[model samples]
Target chain A: MDRILYGDNQFFAVNHISDAKSMEQSMKFKENDAIIATLDQAIEAGIDTFMCTTHDRIAFVCDAVRSNPEKYKDFKIYPCMPYAHKYANAVTELGIQGTIKQYVPGNFFGSMFKGGKALVSKDYLAIMELLVDAEMKMFEGVKTPVVFLQNVITDLLLGLGMDEILKGFHDYVREKYDVEPGFITMNLPKLAETLEGLGIENPIICASINSANFRMSGGKELYEETLRTKKIRVIAMQVLGGGAIPPKEALGYVCGLPNIESILFGASSKRNIDNTVSTIHEFDSK
Target chain B: MLRVALVGAGKMGLSHLSILGAHPNVEVVGVCDTSLIVMGALKKYTKFPCYKKFTKMLDQEKPDAVFVAVPTKLHYEMIKELLDRKIHVFAEKPFCLNPEQGSELARLAEEHNLVNQVGYHNKFIGTFKEVKRIIESGALGEIYHFTGEAYGPVVTKKKDSTWRSNPADGGGCLMDYASHVIDLLNHLISPVASAEGTLLKSIYSQHVDDAVYSLLKLESGETGVLSVNWSDDTYRKMSTSVSITGTEGKIISDASELKVFVKKEGALDGYTKGWNVKYVTQLTDQVDFYLRGEEYSAQIDYFVNAALKKGPNDINTFKSAARTDNAIALIKNNSKTKA
Candidate 1:
């Protein structure tokens, strides 16, 4: 058995490494030995997943995998990249590998570095081609297949010509780049319609974990509808909203959702890790 | 007296042509575009003299003003060339790829002392202006925090490889959509101190952010969340809304609807008031601001007067445009964009 990805007993914090300084702090808890010590500790405590929210956290989390390479040969790490950063296989291989996807190119409106500018044009098709090409190049030379995590916002899409534009880009990728990237739908209803329109059959999970409870209520029903028509997968994120809510509440929320394969979580301190493992254990016992 | 020519017949150009074509004071001298197909269609549709090249059109027509409605990549060169000709200009939103270009445009316009404007039509929306009025009036009382939401269906093209997705060409949902929200935030809350957010979608391309959620902190200790995206299926739910929670009351405004929710004291408990929508069209601000004398003149009389008299009726400037550019920079700086 794959062991339930989420249960009443297992829970974790959704944390991102703030800076390089925090890396030192992370080492102390896991005992300056290897990165997986922490993962091992959490796993011993019954927690199954650890979500590193930023690229900065990847190295610290990956130290375990790098040190013991084979120990975690079976484990999966989900390191959150703001966007294109995850494409850097050098750093990403150490931790986890999930395609980090974002909309805005470069930093909002700053000057571009050489070979760093985005391919832009007035013709929407031209832009779509560039995006697909980049996706192809980014995913190149990767041992582990990546599932692009798309965190979409509802308000922004409608403000622009959403349907016509997204379809144009997606179609271009499918035709030109030959990649049908996976998306984590923040808005379930919209994602289903988008998938149906494109005739695409890939997994589409709920974005982040904070809204696990919200998705459980009606999102699961919507998830079912999409799955019935197409072949999209579903998952959850922000399970604890950065540890704001207690671990149990977060665990219960993800545990409650149907067909949820993964719930991404983050941790800042050892106590958080212990609490998360304990929460997972408690949920499992119940 | 103010000779003006247009270089495109697209929807926006047509809108401008309609207004300028019939104005009593302004002369609708010429229109140009490389697309003879679109030109012929437009001429048959709207009936205006069309040219293949703007330079040829400008040289033959000798208009005092020029409107560059071409693609984003073409903007810088065209505007610079026009400004070199000592002509005034008006461009559309996502002004340039970055703030530096916007500032350069502003500086060049100033160096030439030309009237420059950008089409941020949302700003002129009556509801937002009224909300601004209410905020300025101190009715909401001590503005605290705000959340602005602008979302709609995804945008694609008939053909592939269009400029909208190009990062260098002022493409992507962030520049195309969110910049409007950022501009509005700049207007409502001056000087964004810091901004941090994540781009959520790559549905369209790897280089662009289709969906983004950002937290902005103003220099005045006010915080706001601006969520802009091109990823939703509710096509008609296309709305721009602003919610402000103040010490005394709360004010909400979207597109053309503005409302205020206030706390009632002892005497006025349970009573609801001040939900006035101010029945006015959004375009009126631009119309009235630019064409004050005439009630319903298709042409902006002020643009003509400014051209003829060489005096002043130009309401927008480069500095104001630069502020928008800078705010967009702040947004990009704090973005978590790698893989």
Candidate 2:
């Protein structure tokens, strides 16, 4: 992961604080051109690594990046999987079978048989891999060095006592996709502990690391303790607490923390991106 | 009489409730939904108690079986809990969100020896069933290729905030409508061996897909194509059809009719073997209660009967639905790779 990775939350209508703003952003970025323009702006400011959800629209963005290779030649994407909402909407419309058929990789029969076998044999790891591959489909021919699981399925699986799937994900991404597997969770400390239990040393985990502790489960103190002691890579997100914390103050608080190798944030404008990037640089130098 | 409780009071749930209520061999113990407004409206029609919580309904009713028509995301946990309590389950399509949950539930059902069925009512449609029979009887000999299509006018515009449009809630045209077509393909043709050239496009809804297209290869040396669009307002109603081509004949089927074209005349089901057309009404099962089609009632009756061990417990097992899930997984994966 890059020291500063651009996120896709702004393009996908995700607002932690206001639904109205989220809706507005969704409408604004509904067009691929708008999204590309913003990405280009970020690139102009020297932030090239994009940590994005595997939303359907991102496929169009990937197309933009692939077609203009010179523009994004050094750019990279970190795809998050099971874009829960994508799967949910897909299942709602296409049904489970159709959803799987639509997203699962390989020829129809082989993938179906693999899916069927996974279903019958309870080989959820295979299903998880299928979903990961499906989500990564858009990033084909694009550079994806880090693939992470979204917090939706991450926390769900964590709560379900299905940490083995997490380990399986880590291994699958490493072996099959040849990318570092990252896990995003609301409970950073717990996820770290779970990953360690599976013998995943120094795992890459992304979570909320902010002064306000907005949406940070298990509190701030535990996260700091885990970061200091866990020997894992940390990507601090929601550093602004969904806009509750000011940019400079939030960056100062998080940049001062230990073991945070990277910072992930989403901004729709060049000013916000430049300001956030510069602020982090200023705080880091201090 | 087997006592049954219903979870989810939405469109499909209500449909199940209607048939379950009228069945003489079954008792509708209760209905449950998260919405008081929906439960209230449902309460007006039936004396069966309504509750907001499923656990309370289950504890109070102690129904022998549960019919789940909830969202796909809710299927795994709810069905797992019911199966844990040794309750038979007949859930609506898309069995579970993914194969893992489907497998777990299937294993639970098998371990409990409970009768389980997924609501692939298209399999119960007379013309489709006839299509299956014709193919199984070697009428469409040495089948080589098939195509399944489903079109409707569900999400032509911006959809309301419902589970049907929310991806987190497992709502999308690919899952909702295309699942039927995929299941039909699994039932009539051979199981999908591989799929390519797949696309899941969203025209109107931001989250859910409105259109899907796929090219598939079946395990039995056959090929398939699936094209579905839930946002197609040009169609008056939801139309699902399948066309199969083989060495001996071809069968084209829709909701109301099955058209067969054979290379030679052979006495199979009293057909001349050349361009034989059969209306769904002619092939449909005679039933006491009919709403939409007898397939709904037929599927329900089959589950209820199978639950009571009065007949073979083979409708559409979770394993079978899991096969559809498998095919879907392949199609989705193929589409993504190609994209």
Strongest candidate by TM-score: 2
True lDDT of residue A230, candidate 2:
92
lDDT of 1 by residue, B130-149 (tens): 66766776666678899887
User: Looking at model 2 chain B, which ten-residue stretch has the lowest summed lDDT?
Assistant: B36-45
**DockQ-derived CAPRI band for the predicted complex in model 1:** incorrect
Worst 10 residues of 2 chain A by lDDT: A115-124
User: What are the per-residue Cα lDDT tens digits for candidate 2 across B122-178?
Assistant: 988878898889888997778887889998767767745567787667678777789
Query: What i-RMS does each candidate reach, in Å?
Result: 19.3, 22.2
lDDT of 2 by residue, A1-286 (tens): 6789899889887765544466589679878999989998999988989998887788988898889889788999988876666565454455545566667666643544553332322334565677777777779999999889888667655643456667778888999978899998876877788788889989899987888754455566777898889989999998987775779899999999989999999999888999999999999898
lDDT tens per residue, model 1, A1-286: 1222322111121122111223344344433333445457656656554433233334554555556656655554432223322332212122111111233243422332234343242323443444444433332332222234334222123112144544555455456534444454445545556556657556444454443232221244554454455545555555664334567887876665555555544454468766765675566557
User: Each candidate's lDDT (Cα)?
Assistant: 0.54, 0.79
Distance from true position, residue B271, model 2, in Å?
1.0
Error of 1 at A222 (Å): 53
Give lDDT: candidate 1, residue A93: 20
